[model samples]
Target: MMKSLITTLLLITGISMAQPNHLPTSIPQTMSFQAMITDTLGNPITDGMHNFRFRIERPNPVQGGQVHVIWEETKQVAVVDGVISTVLGSVTPIGAMPFSNNFSLSVALGNEVISVSPLTSVPFAFNASRAMSANNATHADTAHFTHQAGHAHHADS
Candidate 1:
């Protein structure tokens, strides 16, 4: 019993001397926010099906801080108030090169989607007030987005 007690005390003291309580040393990491949206049948969604039109001003890159990466199904997409949508944006958090299932991102547009025009699929209007006024509106096409990899980002208001 005395031998076991002494060994246990030594082990605890050793661990206390060696272990760290804080997060790992900070690195200038760039977080990538990526999403792979799929259909109900689990097929990859093409850019042709979406209109991306949202405006965002990214945070000034911090020294030694990981950059945030963002990706979404639409920069701008239709929103209807009374509608329940199954459309979800798949996400990958910052610094993850090969995206996995550790993160997911999702948002809703509005109330009722009476129609979606094939010609104009993008949902974000530069005119925020007017876009909100209209029960339904159009926005930037998803294919038009110039994604800068490794840039951290989120919605602008």
Candidate 2:
């Protein structure tokens, strides 16, 4: 019995140590994604009730092909004032960490012909940006970067 216990303890410790310090310790990380989709005229779009589908496309198949699109979440759209916002709150399953293809959020305006592109959000890494210069030089708002396992944001910054 003592021998078995020791073996189990050693195995567990080995597995734990093998995990990189930067990676998240938890399994399947579900995160919320939020975005505002507007029209070219800067008006909140009201195309019936829209639905926001959060998709984390798996990275590609190649050894390092951006991970499979492993994470996907869906939620209805909500309009506050004139701006429309889409939020999938904690819907993604834990362990769905796909390699980061474009972390994309798509808004279904219900019409493909008159589709609204301005309402679309780019990959997950991009945050809403504001221009600090008169020329409107755009820089992402860094306050919203998410912490993921095996990823280091502070060190990258």
Best by TM-score: 2
CA lDDT, every model vs. true structure: 0.36, 0.47
lDDT of 2 by residue, 1-157 (tens): 9999999999999999998756444443544434455677877666555655555443355767554434455556665654454334455454633332344433344343222122244464353222211222223233233322223334323
TM-score of each: 0.21, 0.36
**What TM-score number comes out for model 1?**
0.21
**Residue 121 displacement (Å), model 1:** 28
Superposed Cα deviation of residue 151, candidate 1 (Å): 35
Off by over 4 Å in 2: 1-28, 47-49, 58-68, 82-89, 92-157
